[model samples]
Target: MVSIEMIVAARARLRGHARRTPLLSSPFLDEIAGRRLFIKAECLQHTGSFKFRGGWSAVSALEPEVRARGVIAFSSGNHAQGVALAARLHGVPSVIIMPDDAPKLKISNTRALGAEVVLYDRAKEDRDAIGARLSEERRLTLIKPFDEPQVIAGQGTTGLEIAEQAEEEGVSSAEVLAPCGGGGLTSGIALALEARTPGFRVRPCEPEGFDDTTRSLASGRIERNATLSGSICDAIITPQPGNITFPILKRLAGPGIVVTDEEALRAMALAFTRLKIVVEPGGAVALAAALFHGEQLQEDAAIVVTSGGNVDDEMFARALALRG
Candidate 1:
């Protein structure tokens, strides 16, 4: 479904549009990790997550006439904001279907970006079904959160940055840790690292109970999460890995990693104090694994993506409290 060429093409499309988010390192974090730690702080990206890259890629790939027809998408939050913002930028109309339980900040931000917001009960209703109905009724093009070739290629650009940035920093080989929802980010990074920076690895990181990608990798097939409504990492509570994304991840990624909400919160706290940045729970998972599950990672410098920073005030406070 994707390749390094696609990632390169997507990166060209994203230049001057997407921020080439810089990699950050900290002495404190290094002490905690006992290895060199570089954070690709995509939390600083537009729309507060890497989703913006894929969203823009999908929107930008649309034919001019088709772009005028507008687009629809389903996201718990990050992708919603991304598509909304991308549509606004391209002067395309957008409608986003989001769960009622998604973070209020994310919902509000999405709407503020000018997309119509549709709410659904995550437990009682199927977001995709609702989105499909809307798409059919409105004739809006549907841009999925992940699972699309353009989306995966767009997300892969982050890995391109990691490889180039690491080399600039004089690092030879590294294992990458990225937050996993449906494996878009992980798989995309895997493809890029495999091509541009041989020997570099991508590992999927997820919340404990919702670690479907982890289990799926173990069994060599896709598996569903028993419950998705729980994790504090709301941004990445996808039920299973995407069909297109799974194969790439299965081939290039290392063993999956899991961290608890507590660990995620603590990692968020650490990011704030050590990195001087705010990170949401889902965004902190990779860093959480780096900080708390180090034993499981490859014996090399770790490059972790603190994927986003769109948390609600209350939750951000709770994450900060863990610091004390």
Candidate 2:
């Protein structure tokens, strides 16, 4: 289990590095849910996602000699960009392995950050195998997206900030919801909330098709989806939850909630129109949960962490049309 002291230390370490993203009250959401809604806009975070916080924290904690050897990662999008940018900042070479079907915009942006890109077909090739081979051959440090303790500690910073902001606004006992991919962000958020606000519930919201966390929690063990079917929320399509994250989530997060792709699209459009923020479908899952499944959450202020804002232009426009 992650400790509160570690979360506090992470916040201190990431103070100047990660943006202190705004925690704003959304009247539109409040009206719909009949309760106050506070959004932690991590979509505005550096590299357009909260993954940067963990990437930077992990790299910054490395020994000087290990840093010299450089780093490698496998990600669909946001984590790739996070590792790429964070490696560059630390004067280390970085390489990212991504599924061939990952967003072109994200791939291009990661390359723009000077990271070498390796593409693999999700159907025919295993990205983790490729990453392992590359790590062994190149003597590179592997940064598993959500499995490492350091990464979880790094991600905990976002929750720490939310807790502080919630307290300042006099909102107690918020039901904090975050989208679950491999569970890094949700687990980290739960750690911070558990430590700071005793009674607050932390929930992991996921797309219905790719809800491994929900199943894992229900079965009281790790579960795997045999295959990942694409969703509008591409970012949370991990075939299985991480070994490290599942146990933490089982201990801390409330029953995982699954929302549909249509619900996610509606939440994305709502964020764009009402908040003037363009959030990726994956990032909007928390809000979707609030909108579509409010009855499941405790009737108090709910803090929805919008995790990223890296939607492609075409996808963004299409989501708007679908929602309309």
Highest lDDT model number: 1
- In order, the Cα lDDT scores of the candidates are 0.92, 0.88
Residue pairs with backbone overlap in model 1: none
What is the TM-score of each predicted model, taking all chains together?
Answer: 0.99, 0.97
For candidate 2, what is the TM-score? 0.97
lDDT of 2 at 321: 99
On the 0 to 100 scale, the lDDT of residue 312 in model 2 is 95
**Each candidate structure's count of clashing pairs:** 0, 0
Looking at model 2, the pairs that clash are: none
Candidate 1 error regions (>4 Å)? none
Determine the C-alpha RMSD for candidate 2 after optimal superposition of all C-alphas.
Answer: 1.2
> Which residue runs of candidate 2 sit more than 4 Å off their true CA positions?
none
